[model samples]
Target: MDPTHADLERFCAELKAMWEACGPPVLTSVEKYGGPKKSQVSTILNGDITTVPDIDNVAAILKACLANARAKGLEPPANAEFDYWKGRLGSLTRARSNHSEPGPAGNPWRDLAGTHPVWESTTDREFFRPRVVKAAAHLFDRRRRAATVLAGDDWLDETLAQRMTDRMGDLLTGRLASPAIRFGGVEASLIVLAPLLHQVRVAESAAALIGVRPIELRPSASAGPLRSDYERFLAGSEQSRLVARTELTGVPGRTGAKNEIGWWLFHQWVMRRQDPVPTATAPHDLPIAEEPLRTVLAGTLDRLVKLFHLSPDGLRNKERRNLVHKVSHPSITPALQDVRELLVGLLLVTAHKLAVELTALPSTIVEHLGIPNPVDLGRLRALLTGMTWQPLEVIGIGLYAQCHHEAVLEALLAHVRQTDAVLGSVRDVATDRVHLEPLLRLPPRASADFVTPAPHPDNHTRPAFVVPVTRFRIDETRVRELLMGEQLYSDRSLAIRELYQNALDACRYKQARHRYRAALEDT
Candidate 1:
């Protein structure tokens, strides 16, 4: 075995031992600077070595492990222990020259590759998380829009729309618990999206979903010559919006008329008997209202269909496309690179849709609430939404890294965060919205980090309140009798005498203290 690879493996093994002894902390809890992402840290703990580990990342993991140990009441590792690990890392770093660069290999769908460089904290979120979220959001939005328009005059299917909204929230926030949505892989995207795609029924509301009417695209001699096909297609009143959407999709074939867009939308990329399959299942019988519009739409539809790699007869070939259906159904022996390509393409399309569409609008709760500060309202919405999606997005980032590296599945379980814990945070924020409103508006720490409420203090039994003994007693009856002045003089006289004695005692006590202080000064 290569010396560097061997040393790297040994380092990983020892690191794992340390983790088990300290704790495989919830990876996110490890506080370190300039460290590898939690997912990479997780891989290290699992002894899945591909590249030379960063020393700072290694030190951070060790530090976190030690911190966890200290929290658990274990004795702190001595300086010598730290020095030993540091020495190991130093040796591994020096031997790094002998190690060959890593590349992709493994199960096409799940295994994380070794070649994918470790993600930094910020870059992880920037690359792939937003794309998955935005895709799901846009796709969910399009479905809702289609439902309202196509359900016709009698359409009152609020239930379907609500379910879709909830499902979208659940998926985005990582509350939904299914393997299909867990990994943020192409399979996961396809699985989460497949049902909604079927529900859209593109033929019935093609015009509405496409967002532009067929008649609106009528050829005009008044329109000036264009330098590019894109300019020609977008020439008109809605040209600005169309140009923006095109950039958003990143798919050149996306800009087209209702029928043309609808054709692509209708085809569902699905898992059939555990194999990837693309079927023209959604009906495409939308009628062309005008003959001239119909002729124009047909040609446009043909061109887009051809551009997207579908046969004229609606048959799909085993070629790379927007959806990952290249593998023959039930066959698992395909090249890893091909699988990676399919996933990348699918994700890119979804992410592009997310970027173009209005994905970051406030949730309905945020919109309806009577929050005064725009900043507070916006931040609260982000907190609620980010809590839901961040966990899943992290996993998506890992998958994106893996595919990008062209590597196979490593330890995917390592990437999973406490999603339930995350959703619980969302619930906490929503339930405490009334209480949180004031905090949300406060300045100079307005968006201070929120802590989840601890269990009620009342849950455990404690000592009861202690009542103090009476320092004095009120003689209400005597006072009333005295006030009347009709009582015998002897009884009134006794009460008055007692009050006088108490007053004299207090004055004398003060006089004595004063005299004593004077006497001490004289001495």
Candidate 2:
């Protein structure tokens, strides 16, 4: 109705904290500073007023507090604090007016059907229950419409009809009125009704496509539940009388028991009818029909390059393989196999690009880039020789000829050997030298050698070696400075209000849980 007594008390406590934190200046000093007297401030802070304080008085007190904060070198209160209080005051004023007026007839609390069992508090129940009830009612109405269509064919047997009647009666009279039927239960029951409605709709669509004669097939004495009827329709095992009564004249396949009647009819009418092909130039660039397939392929390639550091071997690791499977769509079983081949192809392409770039480098640059140490040169050659194009054959088999594969493999090997020879020659030269140290050092002609840079005066000023240090602790002096500072008052009150509201909400939640638990114990 209005701001509750507890809410007002909480607001007063927050106001007092803000005032005290601002130095709680003497009442005479506040009066001298063009603000209300100390007694008025105390009355406001102590929640002594019969009504909420005037906005002007509140503003004056805040201004005085700001003055006190500035005088003490503390941060002044923020404008946001004033704005928050202004909004609260408005709400309280409106609520007070509403409290004096008569309420509507129905009890909002009793009318609420706690349909969602997951509701953590009474407030959530009150807020969400009505919305859930409306949605369920909408679904129920749609289900009945579908039922009416099915009833024309005499599909509604006596037992099935009675079951639907009872369920609808329970929904309208009992569950809708009772507070016990939670959102979860209502949702679950709706799911149970969905399949029956879906089957009926599918049957109607299939019958229309096949151009079957309309027969008023009612439920016979031998009819079972709606679930059974739906199962029969889906399985294509329903009686021959329910199947397409007309000859499937143009349709090719002979009717069989194994095939579902609706699916057969749909396949004949829809699947067999092809639309004209588009004349657009880039037909091959059409979007993938399966979104998950594209997503998995893109993600796999990205992760293979970035996360796995472009290492083809990393793709074969158990962890990476498992991740691929985990993200793959369950419907696409060959997704993993396709990913493996594509990853191998991508790796080969990357290797080919690298080889081409390396071979393009001038012989002078390549010689200068050679490994200086014999041990390093030996390792380089071993690594290069180990690079084989055997895996590319898996991708190139039908995609490319054997001769082309061999030619590409030979080119890759030639590049590796040429690079290895450059390193080997450098290693030999370094070994033959009387002093290898000079070869390892930067040449005297280098720019770095010509320009001598001065060292930084402070070790801490050097970016390479400098490390940052931070210490955290509560300081009253700093806090006071902050309170008196200009930025202090801005967002402080809004934050405190939110925190206070959350605390009150948490209390209500615990109370609701306690009540729920007690109810469970009683039952």
Candidate 3:
């Protein structure tokens, strides 16, 4: 697939090796087994092709080779062999067209995708998944309620709070909803809560975000399975995007606003940022509907709050305070149970929101963002219709919990307990006033006890035997022999040939890096 045909030749050579390993079946026999025509098979097996072969032909040849391998009583490749080769085929296909425009064929957006800013809308059902919309609604609900709570609790200016909270209530719970909420309130609420909300750290938040090792959650534990799950999700997201990319980009006239709207939905809904919609590097500003955007976000928050079992609005000030209360405070340590639940819920909403946003974008853009395609939009509607989003019970727990929530929750609970114990122990005996000085001033005492052995009157000698665990160690001389000796190569000239091949491969790899800036940046 490479422009120089090096990769294509390498692929053919590998196929030839596979064919030879399978007793070097005749071209006719391979063709009989549903492979390409005899002449084409011969050319392919000869490893002299200049162009990338058709995928169907490659698949057929692989099948025939696999069949021959099986007939010779040899061990067949793993079940994923087909998939592995299929991926290689896809890579080759992309490499073949590396110089082509990005995005779907015949689309002008393909040319403009990277040069111009993208547009997105959170309210667009076509763009956002239902659950994401639902999640956004919930977030909106919380922000408004939080604003109202701050107002009633005298945290904000009374008049401003009143304007924000007015008519934003549900009749049943005496709370507010999206339709009644004002744009001023939405913006104000976001600014006001940004500080507190930003400070609220869930132990697994970083792990969830980066698929990195659990940093805040675990003090000493390894990242464990978290990284792999996140990696898998990312891989799957990319795969899904690739599968659906052509269709998405093929949507006619997809130059400016739609792309921006999709990205905005992703950033605001999935990433949960309140920044204004992005502008193009071009001089002109894109016309974005501000009031509608604010309305959609407000709605999603309200829905999410209800999902969290909180009132939409009204005098839920105490409950709101507890929701955002700092987790480290000893007085409110037990309140972390609810906090964990809320955090988990937020994660769920974000996950669904992310899934929706990615599914709506073109493959190139999705690849650029490295976002997850968690659900197939086509099937998601039918699948999620009967389902209710529950954070504590079920939903995203299988993958999200292992990678993010589960360990962090346990660690958080343990941390709370430990803090409570330390604080409890430092209480003054006479004055009964809690003293904080000892905690900072004194060194930590050992949690476990140690004792010295009593003297042995007989003075008898005792020996301890420990079992040895052996590991393979490479000898320096042997490594040198392996590298330079005739053990590996009968002809010394073969070594020079391999080195030259490796040099060429390195050049090809560098060229590939130059072709895909996004992938290069990620690495």
**Any idea what lDDT model 3 has?**
0.34
Model 3 C-alpha lDDT per residue in residues 136-224, reported as the tens digit of each score: 23323333333322221111111211111211111101211224322122222222222112211110122123334211211224445
Sliding window of 10 residues with minimal summed lDDT for model 2 = 442-451
State every prediction's TM-score relative to the real structure: 0.19, 0.21, 0.27
Write the residue-wise lDDT of candidate 2 on 1-523 in tens digits: 1234544665577667767778875655656545677788788889877677788777777667767776797764322145446655654453343233222322111112223223421222443344434433333333333333333221121122112223333223421344543222212222222222222223334333332222212224554453234334433422233343222424443322222223333333322234321122111221334455334433443333222122234433446433332122354333231222222222222222222232121222222111221011111222222222221221210111111122232333444444333323323333444333222221111011111111222232443122124423365446755765435656667658767999999999999999999999999
Q: Each model's C-alpha lDDT?
A: 0.35, 0.36, 0.34
Clashes of each: 12, 19, 33
lDDT of 2 at 522: 100
lDDT of model 2 at position 288: 35
**Model 2 off-target regions past 4 Å?**
1-3, 32-35, 77-80, 101-523
TM-score for model 2? 0.21
Off by over 4 Å in 1: 31-34, 76-82, 98-523
**Mind giving the per-residue lDDT tens digits that candidate 1 earns over 1-523?**
4544565776687678767777555687654545678888888877687777777777777778777887896654322144446555554553353122321121111111111111111122333333334433443444444433432211112122223333333333433333332232222333233333333433233323223323233344443432132234445333333323323334443432332222211211111012222233221222323343233323323222222222212222233223322332122113121122232222222222111111112122212222221112222222222222122222232111111000011111111222222222223332444422211211111111122221222232431122233434455446755675546455777768877999999999999999999999999
Q: What's the ranking of the predictions by lDDT, best on top?
A: 2, 1, 3
Worst 10 residues of 3 by lDDT: 114-123
